[model samples]
Target: MWGRSVPSAHRTGRWDTGGVASCFGSTVEQTASPGRKRGQPGACWDQTGANGTKRVADCRHESHTSHQTRLPQRSRTGPARETPAINHSGIKRSFTAWRASRRGKGLDIGRPPEHDLRSIMNAILYVDRTGIPWRYLPHDFAPWETVYGYFAAWQKEGVFDQLNGLLRRLVRETEGRHGEPSACVLDAQSVKTSSNVPAAGQGIDAGKKIAGRKRHIGVDTLGLLLAVWVTAASVSDNAGGMHLMSHIAATHPRVTKAWADTGYRTKAIEHGARLGIDVEVVQREPGTKGFKVIPRRWVVERTFGWFMHHRRLARDYETHPHRSEAMIHIAMIDLISRRLTRESTPNWRDT
Candidate 1:
């Protein structure tokens, strides 16, 4: 009635303001009733106080802050600075060399890529190392779809496979070994998968007690990947070993001997003999207890340890077996490329 009139509550439990309601059930008096300014209106802020109770106070004037006032744009004194591309110089160099020296180089005819190839590679590696979804890729890189398209295309075309081989050869030579390994180690790692992976693509691993997929891979003594085969976790070790041996035979013919854990015994050994690779089983010492590393088989085991260094390999996320295998190849490609170029990979320990 004077400075500010508090709304009167009626029998119906509604606050009476003649006819209108605004901030909440309490209505603001539009026309000035007494000493209050024109813009001031009673409000219930729709928020809790520090003590966690609602407080209704006398009308206060506040700005809507919805662009009603014009803001001046800052005047630029120099050209805008672009963000540096994510590609490491080593990765860029390795990919460039592979593209130039690889067979069928003439087939690269096209309108040329809209995004930088190095940038594309950086994006792919980002997803692998971070274990993020394709859509969650950082905005600084190419659009997720474009980057994934390039990944899918390159993976389907065996680009990663070839790149892995090139990097393997370079790393082997750097270690004073021949480009092609005459002996190798074989192993499998079973990991759980995301819910999006269908039951058709997943199976329970009775041995490791993991439910998802298994990665069977062959690697040289230097711990570089030679071949990878992805299968449902339920698949027998012998089956995975057979497929892995076949892949290695087709790709690395010079391999004459292989070492495996006891899991790959008769069928796998027989298959390797048929393919001309003498498979030898590396057994643990009779009375050993905890985590003793066996001879020869330790190389493939070390390769799996390297896989855990990349977060994506901690679990199987791909919908297809082939794409899952490609992820392993991509991990090795990133590792070997950096190793050959003497580039250090960054980790959480970096300041």
Candidate 2:
């Protein structure tokens, strides 16, 4: 028969071909056909059609052919897709060197990670800098969950605190200063909490009238962060001072004196005495009404201002205060890394 011919089916049953299979009926010719030869085209029998008229159709020349042709070509081998490394605010070589020297001292959790620590740290900084939720991390970086998991782990391990301490020492040494400061400044800022921050994690600051958390910080005379602590906003400066003093004592043994404002005068003195450190209060000028920069106290205030420049620090969104502390360390690393690089570079303008 002309065109393609289909085989006669003894019973009506559906057939499925991996590819589209066109249905064809027997030719109208009276002669029964033999098996198709190699030279003939492929065909299928269609006995279930409404009309019993014999029909012939080609299966290879159907509409579905276009779809098969459009499929991607199979490949034998290629490099697997990988998450790109984050370069922006990534760990510097100096910082890496410092971390390596200190790595075995801590962070010795058994098996290694799939992603490099540098990439993970950069991913974390990217999240903090952009103020995005953990799940919203860009696909180009390591998986958001992985990055956050490492962040939380490191936070609990006090890795960020170690980084902040080590980097601060390096910065101070580069500036021809002692690795440890003898005197430090104390201050606190009350920041409102975001919707993500639970009510259980927050309290109202009666003084600032802010319902959130208070960031209590200790900075060296050079305004470098020595310690950072977060507490409920309702915690008075005196109460926060006790925690801050204890933290400073543990981390910065060389810090013998701390300067603060009137809010911390009595508590600072009392705590400092117990810790064997002197506390000095720098009171605002009696007649000064607005914006007087009190000496010693202004240094810590300026440090707080620097923290404000980071969008993530504008409000407390972290459910845990430890995460907030890690973010602070990340921000300071960004700042001090740039400063260290600039100082090492020669002044082209002067030349």
Candidate 3:
């Protein structure tokens, strides 16, 4: 009975294992005694033979134990992977969307039958971003020569000047017809330039009181750039009074009050009076030994800060003054677009 006891039908097949059946076609039968552990070592059986004839065999227990022991433990957590960085396609799509918006408004002509507006804008953006010389603009963005040609053509045609005026007017009209600003903030900033540009001659040098050119800007309360004029650095602020106010009066007839610093005290007051504008020059305390910046004069300074975002405006890069002014208009367009888009979006306050 101890010699490999096989279980009968009444037994739940367990150890005291005995004969095996055919292993072919995957099903192999093993017989074990009643109430014995089926997989106990040295007590299990398997059969292997051909044509329904089977051989009884003991499965090597040591080999089975060793095989189980060699398997490596698996982790409960899953495998590792990688993540992507930037979406270049998304940026391209945004640029295309912006361009399409402009085209829908008839503001963008894919290209000039002679010169393309899209290419012109790209060149201007490139130049402004890089602060590079116009001649150095890459050929892919319309020839640098062509970009300059169109730039000059637009300036002489007064397109930039007109655009600046139009933007200010539109903003004013939309803001409940406030009408032209009665008061304007005036400020001047020095734009350092390459020594290559000719120095201001005697009278011009005497006027600005500096070595090179200076840019005087006038801006209204809403930060709209009104008039921009370039003169020699040495030109006294008061000296250009007549010319500057003339430019302002021509663009904005309703300007009645002018605000300026002490440098513009006399002439701005005189010009304002003549144009029916009351001049309000922020006065500095005479006895104050320390240099103090004026507060109300900062509006124009803020507009200059806006322009500085365009790298090209940080310095005057153009060989001609008017071309430099055109770049300013392009910067204004960018600013207006951003402002308008923000205003148009819903829940802008939460954003």
C-alpha TM-scores of all predictions:
0.69, 0.66, 0.60
lDDT of each: 0.80, 0.75, 0.66
lDDT of 2 at 74: 88
lDDT of 1 by residue, 71-187 (tens): 456698555656546678887798778767653566767665678777899999999988999999988999999999999999999999999999899888888889999998988
Clash count, one per candidate: 0, 0, 13
Stretches of model 3 off by over 4 angstroms after superposition: 1-115, 174-179, 201-210, 285-293, 343-351
Candidate 3 residue-wise lDDT, 206-264, digit = tens? 44444556777777887788887776666667756556677888778878767888778
Candidate 1 Cα errors over 4 Å, as ranges = 1-112, 346-351
Q: Pick the candidate with the highest TM-score.
A: 1
RMSD of 2: 12.7
lDDT of 2 by residue, 29-78 (tens): 21112344433443334433677534354344542464556667888554
What lDDT is reached at residue 278 by model 2? Answer: 92
Worst 10 residues of 2 by lDDT: 25-34
